[model samples]
Target: MNAMVQSTVPASRTRLPRKERELQILDIAHARFAEHGFGAVTMDEVAAAAGVTKPLLYAYFGNKERLYSACMERAGDAMLAAVGAAVAAATGPSEALRDGLKAFFAFVDGDRDAWRVLFDETLPAGGELARAVAEYRDRLLALVAQTQLELIPEHSRERAATEVEALSNALLGASEALARWWLRTGALPAAEAADLLVATVEPGLQARAALRDRTASPSTPDRDQGAP
Candidate 1:
């Protein structure tokens, strides 16, 4: 009787748990958004692709904007976590930057769809969504700025904060641009891409540190003049 009752249970009754089903829907929606920009994808298409009814999808996510927001949040958090871990394990600021860049590129290479979702230019320009994206960017900016600050001498860090922030912004912007280019043209592998970025930026950073050192050093009196 128990076996018969189990056999008679409908497939819907045996559906995935709510959390699992939500993940499944998110995965499908992420891919769809990656392939087609935010403006192009429809919730119906996502529901069909995810093998869930539209009402069930709505029940899980509330609406398409929320769904896209969820995808972006997941991708952004994953990326930050990857870079943070890599940076934390590094021995020094230089290694931190290098490892962080490598981690960023690796994450993008491992999941290009997530990359697209996070970086899609077509995303709404102003709203809660925009603020959410900005918050992620700000977090990344803070991470990069912290690393850059370490490159400066401890005594000079206070005055150099603004400059370091600017440089961090530049590096972050360049990295994003390079990532987009890499996605469009797979010429360099992820590690090679990271190396290239480091090669291009490291020299300038080193030079800036040397300049700061020179500026911070006190001038010495010419004692040799009296001896001569």
Candidate 2:
């Protein structure tokens, strides 16, 4: 082909298909929503960054809140998948819990903005995004409860369930708090965060075991008389 003929071609006219354009908008919107809270980021800004107009952005997402919610839903789903897979691969409950915790901290460490949007209370209130976060949080609590039951002695299952719920809430709060702190200071590594959780949880588990033993032991009563 001649150089003049090649120059005459109109830049290949590359255009993204509809699905691709929608995905591109969502990608840009995800970054924006993560960096700026759901209420703070504007559709116009997302559209501008995505090289589309506001109407096109709306066509894909309907509104700002909907867009933010979709981004949050995606993040929540990803986090759940990672944690669930890690837990499933473990051989024991302790290892499963550790793996799940590691997955969560890993995500937080890698994507601080997503962590904040998913966790931070100041972002907004009463939305699909908040509901998604709550749903994931509940699922994690359930996993912790099941893991605790598995680790506990059969006779102590009832008490273990309650204690595990409390412990799970505490661990969740602590991990989230540490994550926020790390966002500002970058002091602790993700592995260190996992270690901290295990260090805190293991001793508690041992103590609970001792208590169960004390409670379940045969009482020194006048059983020789065979009184029912």
Candidate that scores best on lDDT: 1
**lDDT (Cα, 0-100) at 167 in candidate 1:** 95
Which one is best on TM-score?
Answer: 1
The CA lDDT of each predicted structure is 0.90, 0.76
TM-score of 1: 0.87
Candidate 1 per-residue lDDT over residues 60-101, each given as its tens digit: 999988999999999999999999999999999899989999
Q: How much RMSD separates candidate 1 from the native structure? A: 5.2
Q: CA lDDT of 168 in candidate 2?
A: 72
User: How do the residues 113-165 of candidate 2 rate in per-residue lDDT, one tens digit apiece?
Assistant: 66766775666567666676788788867766666666677777775676778
